[model samples]
Target: MNADIKNKIIKYSKEIGIDKIGFASADPFVTMKERLRVQQENGFQSGFEKGTLEERTKPDLLLPQAKTVISIALAYPSKMKNAPRSVKGDRRGIFCRASWGEDYHHVLRRKLNLLEEFITNMYPEERCRSMVDTGELSDRAAAERAGIGWSGKNCAVITPEFGSYVYLGEMITTLSMEEDTPIEDQCGTCNKCVDACPTGALVQGGQLDATKCIAFLTQTKTMLPERYRKKLGNRLYGCDTCQTVCPENKGIDEHRHPEMEPDPEIVKPSLEPLLTISNKEFKNKYGKISGSWRGKKPIQRNALIALAVFKEETSLPSIIKVMNEDPRPVMRGTAVWALKEIAPTAETKHLLQSFKTKEEAPEVLEEVEKALADLSSQGGMYV
Candidate 1:
């Protein structure tokens, strides 16, 4: 019965547009528990993790009488058609590939809900609980255990079919099922991802220091640390440096799902106009995409840094406006830093010095003083 039901579920998953599906016993994730403990102790967690260690690793804790776990993967396009260029005077900032489409949480949840409905219809007395990324159970761990993919050294699940560009979701079920074999690690001795990491966030092959990671850094609502500012490049949301450099992902660009296709302008938007984008405008434009989860502040702040990275002289006025008029202290402080990088001119120094008198926020005032000192040391070149 378990085998027959597993086969039926797999077929139904394919019919529902699931790219890959695998089944596993609802056993506690022993190895993952230890690794997560170490990660917590070392402060390597990104602070976005949802649940306690026990709940995260044990399926039964989440679903009482759980006997099987089902993992599903969906492939998203890696390449954009008609991707817009980021030229000087019209510089742009990027959201990573994972954030290119409608939020995967919504997309995956819909599929999981369908699967749950199918299961309950087949077994009236059985129960199920489904979760995407936000769930207590680790999606990657469940995926790995279910033979959906191997856990790559880059901390991504790398499938032979989809590389590492697949989105994962899982269901814990009361119905017993035969488990699939877990995939063996295929990242042997390849350190390309670690070597190419912008901020050395991939401490070694498999370990990541989330605090130093540009992807995590970009999502923070507070002021970006000076050390990682330049490292951010033009990325406004998540960073895909490690994934891009992986040999496994080199020539793989899936276009299986239309909803996952990127709108080039939305994912890679002009940096200048973002500085003053109203809240309503921002939501209407970017509300559906996963990158907008933190709202427009982080994206706008990253845009400021990105403009500075490019030394976009054309965006100087906008940056100055943000420094002077933006109500958010973080935005004002970031704009001051952007001014220091983009135009450390006599005019900029004068502007900073004058603003310093009226800036009440300690953080923004500190940025103003730093900009003034840096400009003074540079002899304040005229723009």
Candidate 2:
């Protein structure tokens, strides 16, 4: 690799809004393939609908002529207070802090595309393709190889400068360049991430069981299983319990990157307001939110689920509306599950009883009776 060429590209990359950039020789990552094989064998990414062995192993999927991968990481701005300590309107709510702002995918994609254009301009004979977690490229492996960061046990890429809050972007190229040294894995004996998980999804050895994973349960387009509800705590979207406890995520203000601006609505949308919104309205309020793309049902579903976890019975009116109004029986089922978790009051008891006589959806009715059963066990107390 020419030193002058590498220096010029690196300089241009940083100038194009990427905090850090590095190169890795483009070859089928045999080790990553092997790990992926094991993960598939052991069912690591099993919950993912489109994620498959062939889906992950296709080398040409990332770059048709991939000779080298030019990877960059952008630090997401974050604060400890961003994670919710309570379900009150003041608390931001318990979800991943990274999802709080503008979609990192959009922010990082523009930067990667600019860098790709700049690189292509310099090397007219070569080609570059911008990839932002859209292909088979092993990003964590790429991040590790590029010295951008090492993957934490929670599977988040952690940088010394930005901890684990960096969003990764890649520019696959045919240009051969000098690669950076991979960083050493720093997480040793500390298991704060595992200990802090509300669900025991982090079973062991960097394996994540999506069935028990709160983030997975919330974001997945399918139905959430019954057992994971209370374990979800007040998390309405993705869960960030593991990252918050990691030791490496120290120093919130000093080395923090200043470019990221999280959208205010995602920072903290009110629980009461969520029930009244339709999908069209949801698109208007949350279309830009990372959580919004999944559609209003999941967000509304999780909001009711969270209200139940908080046991804030005062949210019952709105919760009851969502329980009855949501067209998706799956969401309504989860809403009833949330109501049960919140501790049923007399009005809620009557509502549950009323749903029993008139509820048509079998899934919704299954849980409606379960809610009454739950209330009976809890001594009919209003939480």
Candidate 3:
């Protein structure tokens, strides 16, 4: 009966657009519990993680009588075709592959919901609980246990077919099923992902320092530390450097779902107009994408940093406008730094001096002072 049910579910999953599906015993994630404790101790947790370790690792805690975990993966496109160029004057910032297209959370949740309905229709007495990225359970751990993929050195579940460019979701069910064999780690002796990390966020083979990770740092709402600003490059949201450099990911680009297809202009948006985008305009443009979860503040701040990276002289006016008028002090401070870096001049100093008296926020004022000092050292007037 278990084998028959598992076979039926796998067939239904493909019909419902699930790229890969696997089943595993719904036992506590013993190894993962230790890893999570160590991650918390070492301050490597991304803080975006959901639930306590116990609740996350114990399937029965999430759903009583849980006997099997069904893991699902949907491959996403890694490369953007006909992507708009980031040229001079009209520089652009990128949203990472995970944020390209409609949010994966929505996409995966829909798949999970369909799978849950299928299971319930077959076994009416079997209880089931489903969750996507924001769920209490660790999706990667479940995926690994279900033989969906091996956990890569970059900390992503790397499927043989889909590589690492996949969104994961899971369902805990009361029905028991024959479990598949776990995939062996195929990332032997390769250190490309670690070496490729701009921030050295990958502490070792499978561990990551969330504080230093460019991906986590980009999503932060507060002012970014000076040390990580330059490392950001032209990224407006998330960081795919580690995945991009992985050997397993070589030539692995999937475009299965139409909703998952990226709009080149939206994913790589112009930096200047982002500085002045009204809240409603930002929502209208980016609300559907996963990158917009933190709202527009962080994206706009990163845009300023990206503009500075390109030394976009034409965007100086937009930078100055944001610095002088934007209500968010973080945005204003970022603009101040970008203005000096992109087009430092006598006028830049004059603008900094004028804003100094009016800037009441201590953090913004500190940024203003730092930019002033940086400008002065570079031959701009100190006063």
How many residue pairs clash in all the candidates, one count each? 0, 1, 0
Model 1 TM-score? 0.98
The alpha-carbon RMSD values of the candidates against the true structure, listed in the order shown, are 1.2, 3.0, 1.2
Expressed as tens digits, the lDDT of each residue in 1-383 for candidate 3 is 87898889999999999999999899999999998999999988888999998999999999998999999999999999999998997899999999999999999999998889988998899899999889999999999999999998899999999899999999999998999889999899999999989999998988888889999999999999999999999999999999999988999999999999999989999888988888899999999999999998899899999999999898887788888889889999898889888777878888898999999998899999998888788872543
Judging by TM-score, tell me the better candidate of 2 and 3.
3
- Cα lDDT tens digits, model 1, 199-226, are 9888876778898888899999998888
lDDT of 2 by residue, 1-383 (tens): 57788898888876766788877777666666787777667775645434455545454565676677778988776663444344454323444566656666787888887887887887889888766765556677777877888777887888888788778877778787877788988888778888787878787646677667777778765566777767766576787778777888876432244435654445566666776677688777666657665677666667676666667677766666767777778877877877766655776787788777877998888888777877777772542
Candidate 3 lands at a TM-score of 0.98
* lDDT of every predicted structure (CA atoms): 0.92, 0.71, 0.92
What is the descending TM-score order? 1, 3, 2
Model 2 lDDT, full chain set = 0.71
